[model samples]
Target: MGALDFISDYFSISTRRKKRKAMQTVDIKVKMDCDGCERRVKNAVSNLKGVKSVNVNRKQSRVTVSGYVDPNRVLNKVKSTGKRAEFWPYVPYNLVAYPYVAQAYDKRAPPGFVKNVVQALPSPNAPDEKLTTLFSDENPNACSIM
Candidate 1:
């Protein structure tokens, strides 16, 4: 039985199976206007140490990065390009959805030194008192109610 089995058997060197590392995709909101700005933003993030790929859509003004890096670290990289960055809710951590919508954040800053001028902007919750800077204990980064 052993001799017959040995005579019928053939030997060949080959890999049994390959293990692949899973990658995660994180979406970010950007305020990209032109093609140049989009490219610049994409390049900045794609060049990161852990970033695997970058896809920027100008119409939606969003940047999606694929990798296994930390989300906070990726967000910081996006902000370095002079664009506001936040977590995108549409895209999942797994690779399934091909295209996802990214929300863009654009803010306007007060112009000139007249900045020292006083204003009578009322508080959102207070509704009667004025506020220099609105502070919310719950969500500090949220927009103030108008």
Candidate 2:
């Protein structure tokens, strides 16, 4: 029985099957000039296997796809419709520390949102540096130590 179990584990059929994709939501940025463009983009993504829903916001040029699908495949499908497309790169302005930094700020982004870029994130040492400055002798405003 032990030998049989070992052989069965070694030749497991489950290993040959493709792993199933987990549920996920993918947000894409696509410029749609009209209703036809919106419909085209929506239909292209909805027809994909495992896609549960698609929401298109033409005003923001954003398309949200929800299902068990790969993000790259979704982006490619949108691009196939003859529209320039890319993954959503912006995050809510309030979520970022330096949202107004040159690399993160964008005039084209919808209101209350800013581009997500490394340059816009606060440095890991920022808090420590602030503490050091607050206690430094050169800072007249710093509290005097006994």
Which number leads on TM-score?
2
TM-score of each: 0.45, 0.74
Best model number under lDDT:
2
**Alpha-carbon runs more than 4 Å astray in model 2:** 1-16, 120-146
Locate the minimum summed-lDDT window of 10 residues in model 1.
109-118
- Model 1 lDDT tens row, 1-146: 99766655533224345555457888776777888888878888878877788888766556778886667888898888888767653323233221221221112311110111222433456743224334454556546554
- Compared with the true structure, all predictions reach lDDT values of 0.60, 0.92
C-alpha root-mean-square deviation, candidate 1: 14.8
Model 2 TM-score, 2 decimals: 0.74
Over the stretch 93-119, how does candidate 2's per-residue lDDT look in tens digits? Answer: 998887998989999998999999986
Clashing pairs in 2: none
